[model samples]
Each structure stands twice: as C-alpha cells, then as structure tokens.
Target chain A: MARLPPSSGPASPAPAPVACSPHGRFGPYGGRYVPETLVEPLEELTAAWLAARSDLAFQAELSDLLANYAGRPTPLYFARRWTQQAGGARVYLKREDLLHTGAHKINNCLGQALLARRMGKQRLIAETGAGQHGVATATVAALLGLECVVYMGREDMARQALNVARMRLLGAEVRGVAAGSQTLKDAINEAMRDWVTDCQRSHYLLGSALGPHPYPAMVREFHACIGREARAQILQAEGRLPAEVIACVGGGSNAIGIFSGFLADAGVRLTGVEAGGRGPQLGEHAARFAGGSPGVLQGTFSYILQDAAGQIAATHSVSAGLDYAAIGPEHAALRDEGRAEYVACGDADALAACRFLATTEGIIPALESAHAVAEARRRAPRHGADAAIIVNISGRGDKDMEILSRELGLGGAADSPVD
Target chain B: MPSDSRAHSSSPAATPAAAGFAPFFARARAAGRPALIPYITAGDPTLEASRAIALALAEAGADIIELGIPFSDPVADGPVIQRASERALRQGVTLEHVLALAAEIRRRSPVGLLLFGYVNPFLRLGWGRFAQAAAAAGVQGVLATDLIPEEAAEYRQALAQRGLEPVFLAAPTSPDARLAAIAAASRGFLYAVSRTGVTGAREQVPPGARDLVARIRRHTTLPIALGFGLSTATQVEEVGRFADGAVVGTALVAAVHAAVQRDGPGAAAPAAAKFLRSLRG
Candidate 1:
C-alpha cells in the first residue's frame, strides 16, 4: 500500500522513496491505457510527478498553499450529539466541508494547479459531476491566474446550477457535455478528448483517482493530508486509531485520500460507501463494487459496470458525485487484497442521513458525504460504545439546496415566517 | 446479428506475414506507388451498406480495408468518426458483428482486412477467444488503439499464436526508444500517426509527419502507414515522399456519411469508390 501523509502520531515511519503508483500499475490495475498520442505526455507527467514528489521545494509550496489558501488541517471534530444519540461508537467528523470551495476537492485542485504551473502548462482542463471539483478547479485557476475549462454533463449542470455560476464567475469556461447518459461518465469523455487535442499546451487535471496511471496515485497524494490530519487528531482525541473510517467513493478521490492514512493500520477498518440509486439492478445504481466486475473505463482497469458487449452501463444516483460506473484502480486492488470493504447506501437512506445530520448536529452533509453518514449510522450502534468511527464529510450541502429542495418535495410550499 | 461467418472460423490461421499486409505492400512497391488503406466503421448507416463500401474500396485499389468495431466511447477519434461510431453502435454493432462483416468481406475479396478497436471490448471477448475468432474470420491484423507495447505482451502472444499480427501506432511524440519498442512489437505494418491528436481530416499533412516517419524508419523495415490526415491525392503523394502507405479514415468516413445522407445508404459505396480514386489521382 502507498503510504499516507507525514504525521506526528504513530504512522508509517518514513515511506519508501517511490511515491507514485509504481509508475503505471496497482497490482493488475492502473495501466496507462491510451492512444500512443497520449503515451509520451503521460510519461512526461509521470516523470514530473516523480521529480516533484521528493522535491522539498515543491512540497513546501503545496503545503503553504494548503494551509494559507485552501485551509489545511480541516478539523477532525467529535460529534458529541450524534455520538450520544447513536448509543454505540463515539463518532468523529472529518470536516473537509469547511475547506475553501466548500469541499475536500480544493485539496486536489490546489496541488494539481501548482503542478500545472510548475510544468509550464498554459491551460487546465477537468471533468466534474457534483460541481465541487469544477468549482475547486475554477477557484484554483483564479488564484493561479491560469486558463481553466471544466467539462460538466448537461444533467449535472442542471442539478449543480450554483456551482456552474460559481465557475463562470471565477473565470472558467464550463462546457456542458450532452453525450451518453449526460453525466459524469460523459463529461469525463469530453474532457479527455479536449486533453488529447491540446495535451502539449494543457494539463488534464483529473479530479479523481480513477484515470490512467499517475493520476490515481497523484490525486490521492494531493488529498492525503485529510487522512494525515485525521490520524494525528484522532490519536490525540481517542488515544488510538479509530475502529472504522468511512467515506463515499465516486471516482474515489476523497475516500482514497482519507483511506491512505489508515491503509497500513490493520486495526482500522476502511469502508467505502457507494451510491445505491434505487435498486440493485444494473442502471438503477452506481455501486460498482457491489454489482460490477473487472473492466477498463476512462483509462483505468478497475471494477466497472459494463454490459455483456463491454459497453459501459448507465449509472444512477441521487448524489451526482457518486454516480460513476467504476471505482479507482487502487480501490479495486485494496478490495481484492481485503484491505478495504465497500458497501452501498441507497438514495432514501442517504437522503435521510443528510437531513438527520442537519437536524442532529447542524451540519448539512453533501448528498455524496451522506452516503458515508448512512453507513456510519448503520454501523455505529452495532459497534462497542468505546470504539470510534471517523466519517469523512466530504463537502457541504449548500450547493445541493436546489436538488435537495426538488428531491424532498420542499418546493412549491407557502413560505413560513421565522419563529 | 447472427451469421454463418464463424462456420469457417474453427480452423486456425496460417502465418500472418505471408497472408495480408506483406503481399499488399510488395504489390504496391512493384507498382512504384504508396499503398492506400481506407478505413470505415462497420455497420455505419447499416452493416449491409458497409459491406458494399468495403468492396468498393477494394475495387478502387485499396491495399487494405480497416473495419472499425464500434464502441460506446471512442476517445481517440474526432467528431466525424465519433458520429459514424455512434451510428454504427445505435444499430447494435459489436466486435462479433465486425468480425462477421470481415468474414463476409473476406470471402468476396482477397483484400487485406484489419479490425480496429479499443482494449476493453477486445479484452472483454478475452484475448484468446478474440484472436482465434478474428483470425478465423480472415482478419490479418488487429489494432487495439489504447494497447501500448508495454501492456501488449499477452495480446501480442495471443495474436501471434493464431498467425495474426499486432499493429501498433507510433505517434510524432514517440521518442526513438519508444519507436524502437513499438516497431519490435508490431507484426504487419507500423502505424505512424502524423500528429499528436485524434483521427481527423486536415487541410494538409503537417511537416512534422515526414520527420516522424523518418524517425520511425530508423527503427523498422516494416511498411509504415502514415495516418491521421491524408485526405487528398496531393496529401497521399506528399506521404509517398516519406512513408510506404497512407491511411484514409475520417475523410473517407465523411464521404460515406455525406453520401448516405444525400442519397441514402445505396449511394455510399459508389461515393466511397469515387473518393478513394480521387485521393489516388
């Protein structure tokens, strides 16, 4: 397993020299599967990433940005009310929601933007679903004064109108992809096409840990500070590692980020909650690990939802962020090695969890993060009261007001005066 | 899309070097002209119409006919070919359908056959099964667009065992070391991508293309087919200055597309033949 972050607490002591994903593989997964036109650029990226990983100057720059710009060391808070109510394990919340741009996505965006600048790239390109990544990319582009373009599906743009406005206001071009399924999968296709056409001048700042080599490893490293901080904080609070760490897996950036800290800790359980849209049938849900088999999509060899003819199957999810047909290649490797467990959180349960967290703790979790909350709610009461479970609240639900209002039928009702 | 194409697929293939591209290149060399290969998406507009287009391309002196197996997502293709693939896929074309088309076309003409696709569908059918099946259908070479030499050991072994060749693409960005590796892994002909972009028709062949071909020539004696932008006779003649063959993909695809749109599928074959002859003259 790749080592997490440098920590003051008892962590993996001094990781090996190599930091990238073994140059292009994670066991049987994560190969550089692309046209020869992209091979040279991927190689160049891999080399640059390798050089930057150990460069003290580069690390110092990223650390400074994370702290001063994106707001690093996102609090690992004890959820006293939720913990008392759960009546089982003490619950902790990794407050990535408090980060700038309102999500953990800023962690990755800042790092990749810096890398793009370092590489002398003239443009930054990305793909997004819930718009968190897009907003974060746009925010970083504004901060760095770089040209930015984000590919978002038409369906996603509809639900994420708030973020669409934010991106445009932040001076990034938002291209609405109208292709297959009109969601994250299609958005990714359009972004990759854009990158292929202008790879020399642009950097494909992939938002997840699911693309071709280096990216899966690179994005994870960028977000690894989440796990690193949580590990150190949890140790100070609970005096030991938590019994479980839960996060939602879309293309699996945040989950992989937080999981990186505890990957080597055999005592800590890693559970990835995927979006179970409505049912277990294909096209009804986006739970790849629950229903998918090994296949390649968007350049990674991972568990993917595909038809018998190898065409990618359509996926559904109430939370746009978790509505992808495949998981990250490393996540697949971790699943195969029994290092991490994956489960599905249906739309209803996740929605309920979102409201429950809001009412119980005054924290409105993003629908994507609510999947983890739903899983934690289920597993909390079952575990011992002394045991601790850290749930990664990946983002705030402020952007989800539109979808939430529509999904919960909270709209078209007469306004009530504040009591 | 069921057929009797696989009826003759059970018998394994003979040596691929003797069967398809080698003889075609030899013939073109004898004619003192660069080889012309025309590519079309099988089942575009309709599968039967694609058959006529392939036969027409063969009759128009195409050294090889490449049949693109439609996939749900084609990242390395430009808008024209992407739309063609979308049309083919809407008609429910799969690798098996393309193989069936190749088998039918094989029976009617001795022209070289190559199946172009991405890695997922090819691996979905399993390399062993796909190789046997493709070779059985008389396909000479297979070009999995995303399969690089580093990840193609199993694929090369599987295809070579079945007397089929693995065609690899060499890009302008490919360094000499990578070019040598790609050349060593390839069997029939090395695909020299003229530029660092998706397949499309361009106004003129970029000057970088000839340099790329020259670099690739340092690595292999195998015929290098210059691709990505030879849309006219001048362009094909321009390629003859450096490479042994010119691959026409998006340009011919556009011609067939317009023909089908203008006069229905019946006119696509004649239009394709006319387009190829125009490219040669």
Candidate 2:
C-alpha cells in the first residue's frame, strides 16, 4: 500500500495516481522514447496530462464528448438468460460495445482527439488491429475535423475489410503496414516511426493503454472514467459492486480501467483474460501474463514475451485485439501486486462464448470480450448461483463474425448451413 | 536508460557489499557533511586504468561513487556525457566488465557505490537475479536513467523484496506531486536532475534549484543529491549549501577521455584517477 499523506482535516489527498499513470509508471512500465522530432509534443502531452487531471474545463469538455458524441453511460445490462445458462451465476455487462464506433476504443480515441485539438495538432495518426481502434480514431477525427491516418497490417486490412471501408468513409487515409510481422505490433512500429517524422502536425492517438509514459497513463485515464461511472452506477443499481470484475486484456486498457476503480477495494476480485490462441501448450498464445518475463521493448520494461536475445516473440490469438506480445505496463504491475489475476481463453472457447451470449443474452460480443465471457463461465460454477460477475463488453462482434464463422466451419456467409 | 549499461546484481541490498551503506550513512551523520558522488565510465581504455581510477575516486574523499553503465545512445545525456558514453562504447565496455570492476572496488573501498545505467542491461541480465547479485557484490543502490519509477515498480518491488534500493530520479521538470510520488517510492537519496537536459556539468546551475530542493524537502526527508551539473569543488560547495549531496559526471568522463587521448591506454587510468581526486579538494 502506498503511504498516503495525512490530509488537512477529512479532505481526500489529491486523487492518488490510479491505473496507467498511477505511480507514473504504466503499472510499472511506459516512458518516452520516440525521436527528437516528437519531443515537444510529448513534453506538451506530459504538461497537458498534469493540467487536464485537475482542470475543470478539460474534464467538462471530455464529459460532454462522452455523453453527446460517444454515447457513454452505456447500459449496464443484466444478462439474465446467460446467467442461468452459465451455472446459475448472475452476470452483468458494462456495454461499451454499444458506444459509438462499435467498441470501447472510442472512449480513448475521443479523448486523444480532443487533446490533439487542444495542442493545435491537425493530423491524427494511429495503428490498428481488427481496425477497431482505427475506425474509432477516424470517427473522432471526422467529428473533430482533424485529418486522420491509420496504419494497419495488410493482413488485418484484408480480413477486416468492413472496418477499412468505414475508416475511408469517415475520411481517414488508411495505410496498409507492410513491415515487420505485418500485424498490430508492426502497425504500431510504423505509426511510431511516422510520429517521429511528422510529430509537428500529427498526434499519435494511441488505441490502448500501452506504449511509453504519458501514453499508457493518458490512455488509461480516459478509459478509467468508464469504470468510475460504471462502479457508481452498478452500486446504485445492484446495491453493491460485483464479486468479480472481468475484461479481456488486449493491450489491457479496458480491463485496467475497470480494475483501477476497485484497486483500493481489496475484496473486489479483478480477472484479466488474455487470448489463449489454441492453448498454453501450443506456444502460440497471446497470454503474456502466462508466459512472459521482464524485458525491454519500445523503451520500457514490462512482462514481454521475448526470446533469449531480447527480440519480441511472436504472439497469436483468435482475437486480433489480444494478439500482442506485451501487455500495458500497469497490468504487469497489477499482476505483480497480486491485485489482479491474469487468465487465458482460446479461439474455440471465445467464439463459443460469443455464440452462447448471442443466443442467451442477445448480445454478440467482440472476440476479445468473449474471452472474459469464457472466463466468467468457468468461474461462475465454482462460485455458485449468488456470485455476480461484471464484464466490460468492450466491443461489438459485427466485424469478427466473418472470421468466427470461417474458423468454426460454419462457412463464411451470414446464412446458416441449414438455411 | 543508464540501467541497461550497468550490470547490477539482482539483490543489491542483501549483498554483503551493501553492508557498507548503513555504516557509510552513519559516518556521514557523524561527520555532519553530505556525501559526494562522482560518476565515471569504466574502461575509457582497457582494464588497468579503470581499476586505478576506481581506487583514486575512493581515496579522493568521495563518500559514494556513481559508475556510468555505457550504452551506444545516452539519450538523457547532453554532448559531454554523450561523448563520454561514446568513448566507453568505442572501447567496447560491456556491463559485465563494469560489474566485475565493481566487485573489484568492493574488495578495495569502504565508500558507498551505486550503479547507474539505462534499463537494457538489467533487462538483459533479468531483474530478479541481477538484484541478488548486485546486493552480494557490495553495490548499495541503483539509479536507472530511463526506468521511469511508475514502470519500475515491479523491479523496485523485486529489489525491495531482496532489500536493494531502486533510487529514482526527480527532475526539475517533474510536477510537484510527482516529485513527492517519486520521493515516496524511492530509497536512499533522491537524485535531482538539475535541468531538462541530459547528464553534464553546466556553467550556471538552473536558478530554481534551491526552490526545487526546498520543494523536494517538503515531500521527502531523504537526502537530495543534485546532479547533471556540478563539476568542480566550488560548484559542489555551492550546491552542498542547499542540497545534501553533489554528483559530477561529464567532467569525470571528459578527464578520462582526455587521459586516454594523452597517455594512451596505459596513462589513462592514473590521469583519470588523479583528476577525480582533485574534485575532492
């Protein structure tokens, strides 16, 4: 526990760093490492971050964007049918997927767009996987009148065609990243390199809670407002917090957001579910928590799945969102603190959960989110009928249905095989 | 991060070598004088001179020595420190050699020694095991230039679990609250980066350093050690009036570089060691 300064009277000590920037290390990782061209923007970001956390105007504008633009206070729906189907445990979902841009990705993008505008930056650049964050960035960029460029792996652009179309329609210049492994990580590398080149006109709207200092901290702060509001709303609606809080850990922004609200509350069990591609034994899992050690990459140290020589190891997951070799640094610290437990769910399990939730709760979850669903399903039986689990329904699965169907041997078409 | 260049033993505090820290601090308290920390890159040339310089710094009245863990790029450093880093890198000094030299120093000196480097070396060595080894090697503390305290909590925890101090840098640019935050998480002295630029001696110290020192004092009772500037005894004396300690880096490295140039590899050690000892006066 951090030693809190004795408050003058009962006043709460200026809100202690929580999540991302908490302790100023993204969990215990994240720092600035881009080229000199980006230094001023980063310095501005650090300054803005210090100011925005306390500035009422910044908070109010962000709040307004969340309400009017992003459709936040997204429903906390009670999954009654799914609850009974999943071993009699009650389940509730904080439906972030229902928000604008079809996922919680907008929460961070909107805030970053606003920050970019405030900094007088006219161009917004980002890297995407499954194009969820790209679509979100493009959506916000259009809304904010900022020129947007999104770097996505060629493979991802091909697979997530609809999202690519959505981004183009939203006025973003989508670039197919051709370097490295040609995946999300590769896109990030390219985007960072671009930011290094044109940081003056562009702001790299990071999609998740990872990367160097201000980013991990900044992204987490924007996302944590989700948990803060959800926690209060859940308490008001359900009379108390849930026994267990679960979120899929792709870059870990959403999970960290929800989990930060409960860090000081020792009783709330936080579970972060990573992608368990085939299984742990297959050596292809995106479960950094399960199979990583402390290593430096992209300028910070955290639990990175790296080879003996410090090269980033390849990561795999059925969910493009979960296919990251390293998680956000704060998640790494949380894992170390024993405050949160990290688990993994495989391709079949996540897809099955998506199908199960669609049929039982009428909610088709993103593949990344279905991993949490799978985890909750596994734990619900052990905890019994009274257990309450809250899952951050981080995104909608509309984009993933094609891949899911093809992989599940249901054919790539929307029509059922029987039909 | 400088941490990548210095190969610290995983548990620096548990090491019998660090048994010297408590006594050193005790002695400082008795002497009513702040510690002087002089930083130098190891092996500006070959092995022999590096050894001589280490002994000279100890003999020159430096209460603690901060060893530079040289890497190819020292981003947080300015031209002087960068040149020094380049010199060391040119000589092909790996972190392992620095650690072995630190072990040699443990055998020779009673002064407190801290390894300063970027995070790469520690990450390469693996943090947990390195902590244990650093402690055993008699190294007292670690200040990783690039290991932001927020991202270093696990390593800090691991180091703490093993009783080593993960000394953190508190820069003039850091927010007041963050200064306190870093101070709170830090063990040993708080390294105050004198300005926004990298490690080097400046002709004029930043004007607000006294206020920064006062501000840090409010948040942490830990000794405030000023670095990134002080090169001479006069500069040290000036900073010593407001701060508890002084760190000199570029001047030491520049001296080593000059010595290497003048006397070749053979003369570098004595020349570098002699320059460091002069600062103690």
Best by DockQ: 1
Candidate 2 Cα outliers beyond 4 Å, as residue runs? A1-23, A26-28, A31-39, A281-283, A412-419, B1-122, B126-281
User: Candidate 1, residues A1-419: lDDT per residue as tens digits?
Assistant: 12223432223334345434465688788887888888888888878877777666777777778877877778888889999987899999999999999999998898888888888998999999999999999999999899999999999999999999999999999999887888999898889889888999999988999888889988888888898888988988889899999999999999999999998899999999999999999999999998898888878889999888888889999999999998999899899989999999999999899999999999999999999999999999988998999999999999999878887777885788667
lDDT (C-alpha, whole model) for all candidates: 0.88, 0.75
Per-candidate fnat, comma-separated:
0.64, 0.08
The alpha-carbon deviation from the true structure for residue B81 of candidate 1, after best TM-score superposition, in angstroms, is: 1.2
Error of 2 at A200 (Å): 2.1
Residue-level lDDT of model 2, residues A24-65, one tens digit each, is: 464445565332224445777777776666666666777778
How displaced is residue B40 in candidate 2, in Å?
Answer: 27
Model 1, stretches more than 4 Å misplaced?
A1-21, A415-419, B1-18
Please provide TM-scores, in order, for all candidate models, with all chains considered together.
Answer: 0.95, 0.61
Per-residue lDDT value at A60 in model 1 = 74
Residue B147 of model 1: what lDDT?
87
